[model samples]
Target: MTHTIAVAPQATKHPGPLGRRPAPQSVAELLLRAEALEGFTVAQLAAALKLELPLHNRRAKGFVGGLVEQALGADPKARTQPDFPALGVELKTIPIRPDGTPLESTFCCAIAMGRADRASWEASVLRRRLDHVLFVAHLAVKDTPLAARRFARPVLWRPTPPQWQLLQQDWEDLMGKIGAGQSGHLAANVGEILQVRPKAAHRQVRTWGHGPDGPQAVHPLAFYLRARFTRSILRQQG
Candidate 1:
């Protein structure tokens, strides 16, 4: 039986709530002004690791890292700036499967701080926690790290449980959407934890012509990686 899957245009159109922030104009400026960064540049990190990252990927990682850092370490002088009170943040990429098509570029912002009696801090932190992904996704597009000049302070931030849950959910939803053929581009608001979807039971199985083997679900490890990475990111925050 043939099942026609509907390719939703939602991937291309940026929804009002799932939008990204403005791109950084200058990578150099990003390096100088963001207060959240702890001194490692994307270029420096890649160079140290001997990994030749694409220009865009390098810029995206550094820039997102800086933004996440900002969420953790807010600047007092930049009172006009949006404050982030999250305990920690991380950067990741979602690539398009088919060749020539540009993958949806994004960075996930995990918030670990819980608001209690810290009213002022909570206000600033709430803004950061909520808009963290939007801010970092915008920076990722420009390939620039946060500008130290724009920020007023710095700190070594970490993550907590709530933050881990956020990351897990984001990754799972993203993978599930892609697995379900929601290609072209993805939005930041796709927030359902990856799990056995209701439609998964209705999948149309097809045979693979590879050697003597029939079609089988790829090793569960492929899906396990998502969980593994989530754990790794959490460890980094700790």
Candidate 2:
């Protein structure tokens, strides 16, 4: 039997019973709001906010992220910066399997391809994104409908000394490639925990990147945290 949660109109996009939550003033207020949603299933969330879930995976992937932004009062436009600029915090929704392990890699932020060569670890985009993150772990097993998935406890993660070391090391290594104009040769297997992959829906999309021959067309690379790293964070929190 397929156990699914009862949801409101699946086609609706307007604010529903819960309407929309106000922007949290402080980190305390934000966590209070997040705590209220700790155990709620996706259906309950969508039903309350009257959000529509896309039928397709590509569209659904972004819709779920938007749903979190709406619920958390973060502006999607400022994704280049942190989700909540006021609090200097970023909100991330991690899909976890039964054992509380991440089902996939977590998207960190976009790469500054042009200036990556000289970008310092202290001012790197990855560093800023990881500075303070609100990680909302959701139950995301295969075959489970998006609406039926439940959200687990949210973890507020700040890197410790060792965690910082790991990220800095990866950043420096990846930066070396970009600096040397060898970004064209970067593979998914380059970094230990932080890796870069093209951020496009198809092969046709391309972006200008520094190449050995000067400037060349290449896939737009973005930062991603390996599942193992995120799993470690959750385990440590527990």
Candidate 3:
């Protein structure tokens, strides 16, 4: 049976239970706070925090991520840098299917296809965003309501040498393609650890990219960490 989770009356005023200031001082403190949310459903957390749960799954894609940020006392500002700029850590919520595999790739960030040609791995935004990450994995069983999913223990991760190399290779390859004006030919299978895929909500959504004649309209794309790569991380953490 379907259920309509109730919204808190003060949700609008008190967006998160934890107020804005005094963010977590360290990674230990952050994980400790995240651990407190391990057993609660999204609805339960929202209700406790006097927040409103999303009415639909598609519209709520970022709901869980927001909840994590709130629970950890993260800064409210949506910056291009890490969620905890002070700690140099990015927060990522990963959706995992019943079989323990990620439901989909983890989106890194929207990239400017036209500017990618001039980007370098050492100076890439994607590299900086992923330099340190706090991953919160939640169960995404088929047919389950958004409010009912359960979270696993969150892990703070930094890639090992091999993992870093794989990611670097992928980044260089994809950037090379963009530089060559071949972004139109890129696909999901282009990289082992990372992939550049379309990010727009609709097919007609377009972004600027290099063309034979100059800048041209092209599909907006974002960098994503492949599920296999994340699965390997989970195994290592275990």
Candidate 4:
């Protein structure tokens, strides 16, 4: 499938929601721009931006996120820092079922299994990726065409104190297990609010990890926020 980059229009010094700069200068500006996309359909957005929609399901995985970033003037390319690095905010595209429940776990980032000994909850990539988020929920029904999904209003959020504590505990516990040479025994059900799962494009992809015999080949794993956690965020927003 072919993917095209959409260029946002230029903004005046005092721009309205639709005419805002491609890269918003502040959090308020980002939200205002995002809110402007509240009810647009995938096809409508594609037409407005003159972009092509993916023909296959698998190829459309990041399509909505890319669309939102482009609409709000974000870099189409992935970055080590937040999507809006200057404002320290990450943009997440969440697919929701008809009942308004999240369709899947939120992917955090690739875990550094071999570097667990040097990793800390406060300094971990997962924490940094989640510091602040702008969640854009899209309606996704199974077996439906990509262009039919509709966008919901965006919600900005940060973890509450209790939520952060729970996340920190899970991270510490999992890192401890990795440090103890038990990565092979780690399972998706290991954490309460977070889980570690294989993250590569396929099972054949592997990375380094600690093992009984020292470093061993293991499937690359990434941290994911549990659906329950995300559901709570949505419920709280409502």
Candidate 5:
């Protein structure tokens, strides 16, 4: 079945609730600020930030993360790098069940199907993006209204040595095929923890990529961390 990706633009930024508290100087400062809002509901934070909460959330897919970013005073110019590049931290807002299990996969990064990337695992965009992440979770029960969803505990995390191995292996496997014009054959189950999925903003969106028959139109792809893996990261929260 085809997925209709939402293209509705997010509302423009308004003055932050804290009047743009000076950008976080250190990781400690960032976490402290994030933790302070651990129990705030979406309504409370949105009101504070002057955001007009939407009546229907279908067009607000990344709304929560944007709210948290503004709350923490993230710089808008650094969209291509980690959300908080000053502290080498990527801000990720994950939705979780009331019991702490993730509700869906966490978006990792986009893949340029036709472009060559760094061969070194340590130098890859995905590696740097996942290097240091500040995860702020929110309760996402199906029946819960968006405004009433509470921000849960925040966790600062970096993958362990063992975890990195698995991730790197999957990265190699996927990139190998993607680089070799075999993208058409990659199944959804190709990776153990990381998976590549189409990331278009609409059903008909397409991009250039290699296939067995050489360059061809391909579905744009983005990497995602399976919910099972994210649940483990939250479990290991420090």
Candidate 6:
């Protein structure tokens, strides 16, 4: 079961829950840096999906730890193991507008933690992990009165084992599409190509802030690449 982070509008947004942001090369650093951010404070993270996160009661802190763990390629418990190889990565949470649009500016941070490829490494060792993938996201009602669909909390996503394969496939498809000189092409096709479906439909959650409730649906990784490019995605988007 997925444990949802608590939404507390009044809660302070802490960029350093684990203390000391991770470095770009350090998997742990990257994960820590990403985790330190929140929906109200990290716009860059939300922008990855080409959408905005509304800042109502948006100040929240619980997501930092969980997201950081995910970034580092670790589990929710923040531990790394052989079967579950983890890359030191970070996560940032930010907010978007009501209509899932992007703003002029958004902010977020990423810190690297440990090294996943080192033979002497203590973290889990997965042979094929996306050690350098960053995810920015936006959420909303799948269909509705556009304006009524307010911005939902944004998340920084580090691709998991399951997600990595789909992205890799999308990358191949995108290359094929581009090679064929196809027009009107965007990142959204990757989702279609991978058959990436949302776990829920027409669902909403009440956040700590004052904006509208949660989105009617949440794509597992769509916001970051629904039709856009995430930092990591951009690196491989060509």
TM-score of each: 0.24, 0.88, 0.87, 0.87, 0.88, 0.31
Candidate 3 lDDT by residue in tens digits, 1-238 = 3221211122123223553336889988887777666656677777666678888898556888877777777777746778888888888887876455778889998887888778888878788888988888777778999887777766679988888899899999988888778888897899988999898989899888977567899888889999888877765673
What is residue 89's positional error in candidate 2, in angstroms? 0.7
Cα distance off (Å), candidate 1, residue 24? 27
- lDDT digits (tens) for residues 103-215 of candidate 1: 23232222211211122322433334333321221112233332211111121233456754664555545444444434223443345422221112234522221111322
Of the candidates numbered 3 and 5, which has the greater TM-score value?
Answer: 5
Overall lDDT per candidate, in order of appearance: 0.30, 0.77, 0.77, 0.77, 0.79, 0.32
Better of 5 and 6 by TM-score: 5
In candidate 5, where is summed lDDT lowest over 10 consecutive residues? 2-11
lDDT of 1 at 165: 65
Error of 3 at 160 (Å): 0.3
Give one digit per residue, the lDDT tens place, for model 6 in 23-110: 3455545534433433333333333323344444222222332333333334444333221234444333332333333321222211
Please give the TM-score that candidate 3 achieves against the real structure.
0.87
Q: For candidate 4, give the lDDT.
A: 0.77
For residues 105-224, what per-residue lDDT tens digits would candidate 5 score against the true structure? Answer: 889888888863325566777898898988888877788889877778788999899989999999988988887887777787889999988788885888987777778888888889
Worst 10 residues of 1 by lDDT: 147-156
List CA RMSD, all candidates: 18.6, 5.2, 6.4, 7.2, 7.2, 17.5
List clash counts for every candidate, in order.
14, 0, 0, 1, 0, 51
